[model samples]
Target: MNRIEFMTELAALLQDVPVEERREAMQYYNDYFDDAGDENEEQVISELGSPAKVAATIKADLGSQAGDYAEYSENGYTDSRFDQKEMPAGRAYQRKEEKEPPKTSRALKIVLIIAIILVGAPVLIPLGVGITLAVLGCVIALFCAFIALVVASVAVAIVGIVVFGVGIATLIPELAVGLALVGTGLILTVLGVIATVASVKLCLVVFPGICRGIVWICRRPFQGKAVA
Candidate 1:
């Protein structure tokens, strides 16, 4: 949607927010869209995703920032402290505590870890093992195919050489058959070599991508923040 529609939707969603805070958020986004210019309006909307998402993110951020305010009434003296806007929604926020290692009771942590392991062991372990085995199976199959192609290529070339040699060593009667065998072996050798080369190239291209995909999948669970 255009900037006007986007802003209107955002304002509607933020109606429950404090008037001043809502105005501040609207103004912030308005200025952002203004700076982006008409040419970049679509790009901005796409980048920000839906207005509803931005509003929700803002409320979530506000709630987390106002966690301490939970104990106090809305009219408390500390209300102004929570009135301050958090960092904008589209970017990552890192608290100082999040940067440092968290402290936890050793026994509790152990118990929690064990509990998670036990709960997920039946599913996660098998899924992980299955994925690994599948990948390994693919690699092994490719490797074996490559080996077979290379060996076949070498065997065909050897046959061609031997047949050609025999043709040259012998006289007229066996010469034609020997020459035909040599030709057939040479064609087989060429086809085998092509197959081997193609297989090697495919393995080289495909396995690295598979490895990177697996690494990305593995890292997602550990990452605390995700792009909206």
Candidate 2:
């Protein structure tokens, strides 16, 4: 075939390649033809063989070169030359279509997917929503309960201090009872303080865990990773 026919066939064969790569391939062959001159065109085409064969050879070369580059990178040596080169252009990069899917099979696959989604939506959607709501409600309830414990502890401590102060201001005739009141108030104050500290510690530990558990449950259906 003539140069035009040969180049057209080569371009068709290289359609799966990136635009720039195809262009580079075409440029190389065009240069080869020009260097050979008009009289040598036939000889050069014969040397290159069929366009399909030439495209395959180019693909093989690129694959090997890429593997070598990867190996070099793994060995901690980057290839600066590869980084510096400009890309060639043609059609966008795409995986080679080995064979087109059967039209009937493709259509059937789409219909099947749609049908499955429609049939399952009523059950799956409600179930998912219910689970999410339940998890949120539980987390909120636990948080509120912890907050209540802290509030109650503080109130009890305050009442204990007020009783102790009243006892201290009483007359000498009631001094023994006043000392007893002081002891009772001290015990209440200590218990309240302990309760407050314990609740705070519980919140610090349990709140995050609950939050994480809720997050993990919510993401489970979407195939998302759980937090550590």
Candidate 3:
């Protein structure tokens, strides 16, 4: 049969189903044919089989889902054969469509949130401020500590250089003391150079990571608020 003949028969057969379900099923099939196009109409029709078969499948599915209930026609013909295995694939019949939340529920939720904000403003505001201040304080303290480490390393290196210079000046005056001083200076200078390099490398890794973490933390509250 052609699409028109098949769909017409299907609609008549589904008269016992609820109006909404019937309409959805008809719309689904109508859209299916349109999507298949005129060239593939015969193939689509053959795959779907007869309209009576389709209607039976729909009734069986709906009956099973409706739970031990019977659907009757105007002539009092009742259909009670509800086998779950008889359910149709790729059909809108008996499908559970997602429904949006009602306007009243949405409005109530918004009102409840506003009420909570208003009631808790005094305590919440101060608590939020304190938490923000604590975070900022910790970050600042950590940054200062790192800076101090870098500065201390540089300072040690400078001190080692100065001692080395003094040792060179004293070499001619006191050979033994000068040799000891020079050795001490060399060790100190090497230690200072290692410390400086380690401190700089650590800062390079830590600074960017800390900055990114701060940015993420700062954006979190705003992102949640915006989504709500």
TM-score of each: 0.39, 0.49, 0.55
lDDT of 1: 0.67
Clashing pairs in 1: none
Candidate lDDT (C-alpha), each: 0.67, 0.70, 0.76
Candidate ordering by lDDT (highest first):
3, 2, 1
Overlapping backbone residue pairs in candidate 3 total 0
**Residue 54 accuracy (lDDT) in model 1:** 76
Q: Give the candidate order by descending TM-score.
A: 3, 2, 1
* 2 versus 3: better lDDT goes to: 3
Stretches of candidate 3 above 4 Å error? 1-104, 225-228
The TM-score measured for candidate 3 stands at 0.55
lDDT of 1 by residue, 49-138 (tens): 788887876676468675643222232212332233442223322323436667788999899999999999999988989998987798
For candidate 3, lDDT tens digit of each residue in 1-228?
898999999999999998977877677678667656777778777767789987886777576574454443442323344223342223323334469776677788999999999999999999989998998899899889988998888888888888888888889999888888788788888888889999989989998998999899889999999999
The per-residue C-alpha lDDT of model 2 at residue 69 equals 36
After TM-score superposition, what is the CA distance of residue 83 in candidate 3 from its true location, in Å? Answer: 21
Q: In model 2, where do residues sit more than 4 Å from their true spots?
A: 1-107, 171-173, 224-228
Worst 10 residues of 3 by lDDT: 75-84
